[model samples]
Target chain A: MPKQMSRHSTVLKSPRRQAGKPRPHSGEPTHGPLTAEELQLAVRNHSMPLEALRKDTTPPGLHYVLTHFDIPFIDTDHWHLQIGGAVQRSLELSFRALLRAPSITIPVTLECAGNGRSLLRPRPLSQPWVLEAVGTAVWTGVPLAYLLTQAGVEDDAVEVLFSGVDTGVQGGVRQQFARSLPIEEALRPDVVLAYRMNGAELPPQHGYPLRLVVPGWYGMASVKWLSSIKVLTRPYDGFQQAVAYRYQEDADDAGTPVTWMKVRSLMVPPGVPDFFSRSRILPPGPVLLTGRAWSGQGAVQRVDVGIDGKWAPAHLEHPPAPFAWCAWSMPWVADPGEHEVSCRATDASGAVQPLEPVWNYQGMGNNVVQRIKVTVGQ
Target chain B: MPKQMSRHSTVLKSPRRQAGKPRPHSGEPTHGPLTAEELQLAVRNHSMPLEALRKDTTPPGLHYVLTHFDIPFIDTDHWHLQIGGAVQRSLELSFRALLRAPSITIPVTLECAGNGRSLLRPRPLSQPWVLEAVGTAVWTGVPLAYLLTQAGVEDDAVEVLFSGVDTGVQGGVRQQFARSLPIEEALRPDVVLAYRMNGAELPPQHGYPLRLVVPGWYGMASVKWLSSIKVLTRPYDGFQQAVAYRYQEDADDAGTPVTWMKVRSLMVPPGVPDFFSRSRILPPGPVLLTGRAWSGQGAVQRVDVGIDGKWAPAHLEHPPAPFAWCAWSMPWVADPGEHEVSCRATDASGAVQPLEPVWNYQGMGNNVVQRIKVTVGQ
Candidate 1:
């Protein structure tokens, strides 16, 4: 596990790091300590390996783990969920109490708002992500709607704010991790306070005691290690809610808040060389092309593959679970030559992956088309 | 169940009937009789209702069923798989033997190569199809690879042909429904001889005793009610193989043969009025849009949703099973007015759904983008 201290100072220093100069800390954090293994897995400058996308189902341990600061170590016994503010009744529930409440399981893909940030041209200097900050899992927990109903939300309540246990200074503000949603969205039945991931108790890095699983939204909305829920009469102005995570087109205007994930597709790079492997040349024959496509707002409507410039449809496989990624494959007759293969995804909402990513200050939602190169041999 | 007689002569007369004129039999078959129910379900001039695409998972019985002639009643007790030709030894495996063989389950989407035929302009006079002839299912049975290995294919074997018990006259040839694949494809692990669908024994209309399931190919490659497997030293020149199902640019020249599915998408129409329905007028707010997309040649790379001319990416849900269609959704803010919504699919192979279908003689593989109309109320 890695931990960070002097959270506020780090926040103030982020801008200096963003000035396109080499990181002052020389690729090492001055405040946080990371184990060799933890440092090895951190999202420094690399994307999730393209080959990982071919997995039929991502295992929990193997699932990609990403965070803004450092992994917080929380003691489960001391953890509690406090529901207060504009609600008719304020309630404090322990971990056991949450488990005793009515529960449901849903499969959802959680993607960091900056999953493809590194690909954006003139890249922003924040936490550099490159398409690996996403994973799908079956979350089991009590529906947040049930908890809200039990707390007796008042009509005056306009927004629901969730606060997590992780404390850090971000965007020059010292604060606990928090985000808010409109009251109507807070009550969606599919939104849950998950305590388990993929059938096991949630992992420590993922949020052991409890976390908010906001389906169809970017991972930012899913506040991990959740601690408190406040029914607010006014819009939430938490640091995470009103400042850092907001997507701005320019410095002078208030930009749209990053929410659901944009439509995107990534193809698993086929047959590349490894340390023990000697060749990248594929024997001439029918090649099975495969990958995963997803969107935050809806189900994947379709995905198209391109070889150089010629395009064709690929066979889409049924998703193993709802709200999970659909696996797809196509058989390509390998021509003996180098080929640039690409994949594009379209969501049911009619949104297609852009060939070039839309650049933004925060580098949120860079869902451009993905392409890879491969060679076929005689 | 529907049944038809005069299997052979009807096949011979098909070309004469296909010669650009109103069906000479006035929608009634000149050779065989059709039950009233079968005729009613038969596609006349419409595509599968766009509403059907909204289903998260198509129920087994509700899945679309299409056939060339009639549903052949198969008796499991008497059915057996005969494997011969270019093999060291011939093998006759009974239904029981097949059940006892090593088996695996796979989820796959099967689409008629002619699914969008009726949508093509100057519509070719043939088995009219407008996208309904496709469905996804969980197929369970013995791997075709195991059977191929058991028979011990000879060194010179080049092609593998599968024959179904569905005997009928098609394209002027009186024969059983048959298709062939290159030897490499026939040995792939994913190919199976399926006897179960969605966890139950195969339905009569969907090939009861056994069927061939070629995961990434068009439905035509999956011969229904499979009866025999023949390994050949050259390409099998069956009528269905050498003649029909071929794509032709002009009527005079020999056209390229059609294989695998093209990229395509269909939207489940949202909210329509009926006697029991209270209202189709959606309360003005964020509407969740959803649908499924697929391809035969490769995995769907992307799906784009368009409202009039405005397009945005929809969030895609994780696929529930392998080789099944991916469900996708998007949040749309409805404006009060009539709107035309459309979805286009792009496959991993770079094939995109055409705005207008490419007209062909046989109307094979018309993967035109689909559009629908909807109204939003204040």
Candidate 2:
């Protein structure tokens, strides 16, 4: 018997998940043609263009962006970040109050958990990103630890949840765009409540008024348009925390939650592109290749340029900040022929980007190396 | 015989076009599955979120964007807007010099020529927009007419061409992003050399340093990242002017050039949306239906809200500025059942959006009325 379904019961695809899949969607196929839902999501969200790798601090507008729901228009005069739930004394800080708090500005690189989803063989039918979903920005705000301590967090609290005004349904559950971090991790000095990006007030799309900037973790952990904080006594089972952004080998697997960004590198395509095919057409001469490299777990220690599968070390610049991406470059003399160029990065912790994509059901943490093809025209 | 193809000759999809289709792409299908190329373009170029209609002037970060190529990194110190060719006095104005010129700030609504392409049958194989590609921003800069007068246009000049630094190949032609306006239209008091949007310096994505704002014209005519201006004695036949942005009946037609935006109205989807299907769920009773309406041909004079295809005039606020979109709202008693709601706009020039989508080969100037479905759950 076919069961009647109300639209509300239909699972809304998260920014990282496909919609309308079968129940329990275990046999989620690895790859398929892009869907109408995916196209809808793609146009509403955008990523850094590869060419932006040339800049150190990405120009604010060129940074990758993925908003789970509509950007909320906050009236700064009335807006406040309320901290409650299992705290000794709840703290409500107005936008002006937040501005007066001790501020620290630092550069950070943020990459979406599904940065290379489209490159996965059985591509997870989500945003369909082909690399490019990464950017670095200088942020100014108060450290999360500074506020949590001032609010007097209760000892029993196991995690702290952040909630934003943006709301939508995903996985058949209507919910605010929210997430939680473990208490110990939430107290990290680097986690900030940012109000400024680059040198200006936060752009609304990047979460104006107040936003959480969780360094080292994938962008999902850096919640935007934040409105509240809840110190919880128990682990958070929110939709964002327990259901999406997980790496699963099969449908039924509970899946490990994704966190830190993996070591990765991308090159600015080194020639004039054939616009339609995105193939490079270069004149035979010495070509200087350039790119950016980063990782969440540790500093990027090395980058290697792959010319038609042959490896050569590239020069790496000092990282701008603790978690910011570093620029890298190499010189190659062009010959009259077609050639393939690839770049790979290794982090201080020694996690190197894989030569080929490592596929997963939800398509998270895909830090596969990037390769570009160019033809040297005489 | 099967014709051989070189990747170069392959037509790369333009922001408003499809690639690799049958040359003389005349029988371009009206409906088909979304392709990888279209999806790629969608993520790179974003549109306004319908909910943003609530704001009079779109927040800077939420404005719709369509870039045909990578954003150029301009060095303001060295960048200059050179007015040359048929001008009586070829003049070069540095960024600072342009800023020092007389200035004005006004709100202007800009809509993409292909705003509703995705809704067309045999959908145009381009950026598949669904009625969200429009935004209004307050632009501040020198009036373009002021600059032209300073350069002293030669009497023989027929068209004034503007070139941007961003370059890419389109229609198999590698060229900078360029477009031209008739000399008369170029002298309009409202046409401006905008350096600031909504207040601050233009964001890189919106065209930093300098951009052109042609009120009452489709977005393509308002060039960004301006590098130079060439006044031509002969009619301009650049690729952007001659090959793209045209209204055509079939593939082989050298259709009339597309200019003014057609009258259009878009409703904010009333009630909360079902995450997956985007259907609305509302409690039964009186609810406010709100949206924005505008036209490049003339001021939006009226907007009609349709409840189950029944029409009622909505109340419109005086427009924020001559060319900015006006907000409109209507009240409806949503009953407990499935219903379709739609809105249509009529411009002062007597142009009304058609109930049906007006199709075209290039998918330009599609001003179809927008419709949404909802279920009032009792």
Q: What does TM-score give for chain A of every model?
A: 0.85, 0.92
Off by over 4 Å in 1: A1-48, A274-281, A320-322, B1-378
Encode model 2's per-residue lDDT on B50-156: one tens digit a residue: 77898888876678888877777788988988999887898999988887889999999999987888888888666678778889999999998888888898899
Candidate 2 — which residues are off by over 4 angstroms? A1-30, B1-31, B274-276
Highest DockQ scorer:
2
Task: Give chain B TM-scores in order.
Answer: 0.84, 0.92
lDDT tens digits, residue span A171-218, model 1: 434467789988888998989999998787786557767989888777
Interface RMSD of 1: 27.3
Please list the C-alpha lDDT of all candidates, in the order they appear: 0.66, 0.80
- Give the least accurate 10-residue stretch of model 1 chain A, judged by summed lDDT: A1-10
Task: List, residue by residue over B1-378, the lDDT tens digit for candidate 1.
Answer: 001111111112222223442211112222222222222223211123334465554444335555554346677788888999999889999999899999999888777777766455555545545556677788999999898998999999999999988664443345677889889889989899999987878865567789998876778888888889999999997777766666654343345556666777777655442111111334466777778987655567778899887887766665555457787776778888878778887766666778876766667777777776566766
How accurate locally is residue A98 in candidate 1, as Cα lDDT from 0 to 100? 89
iRMSD for each candidate structure, in the order shown: 27.3, 3.0
